[model samples]
Target: MSVAGEGAGVDTGTYRHAMGRLAKGVAVLTTTAGAQDHALTANSLTSVSLEPVLLLVCVETDARFHDAARESGVFGVSILAADQRALAAWFATPGRPLPGQMDRAPHHRAESGVALLDGCLATLECDVRDIHPAGDHSIFVGAVRAARLAADPKAALVHFRGQYSALT
Candidate 1:
């Protein structure tokens, strides 16, 4: 069985192209694993519930940061500002170490010891409560422990059609 309509095989390129049309706010997801910090550029974060303040983030199963976030049981989501395109690119690059990425941009540690990007439009520190396996990714459902908005909330970094955009 394939994960496509009517049992048809899903074309990877087509799926990527179709998904690219959906505009979404960019966020840098971060977590600390042991002595190392891990981060990834993500746009797949969304709220799941309000009473318990549950949210979910999708992480590729093969990504290095996936294990780090799973092991730590905590993650921080920094909603990127329009001017933070470079920071997003740095985190999205494969084989880029967290230290090297930090050299390009600075971040702070939350009370939970999760790495948080500075100058973001908003931030959320979450504690993982459950994980569900998706096709090629794992959906991590978490409870929001803390959240804050940036001092400047003028513009938000958005991604659409495979490019970075600003929604001011």
Candidate 2:
């Protein structure tokens, strides 16, 4: 049965309303596994810790790349700049070819050889530390092995209420 229904008279809308109140920064989660590259635009990313350099990204349980992400053991988190709206759309749309997919986006591979997107505000190369199943999603916790920030400051692209917006 239904896990949420197990509780007596729980208001499901409360969960949705609470989540809607939380603002999140958008990012592109990328990985190369089994001779193919996969990227998805995601807003479900956040820093979990600093002492051990941990971050987390949540992927839908039925996403096409979910298995790849699980098996690859590594992934890249690219914080999209405000100017990269097109890039964000490209990755977010399934069955659409990524622009410049043929040519690497001025990136160097991590030790795991996962291609990280370039020209981002920041990039984190990480090794998968744990995967926790959360509702209809899988939360992948990663240990940051390498990271770099752009020399110049730039606004970040954010997704909210089903649209892409830029920081002022």
Winner by TM-score:
1
Quick one: how many clashes does candidate 2 have?
Answer: 0
Clash count per candidate = 0, 0
TM-score of 2: 0.84
Off by over 4 Å in 2: 1-21, 97-108
Candidate 2 per-residue lDDT, tens place, 44-98, comes to: 8888999999998899988866778888988988898888888788778777664
Estimated TM-score for each candidate: 0.93, 0.84
Q: Cα RMSDs of all predictions?
A: 1.9, 3.1
lDDT of 1 by residue, 1-168 (tens): 345475268787898999999999999998888878888999999999999899999999999989998999999999999999999998999987566566677788899998788899999999989999987899999899999998768689999999999999
* Best of the candidates, lDDT: 1
Lowest lDDT sum, 10 consecutive residues, model 1, at: 1-10
- Model 2 pairs whose backbones collide: none
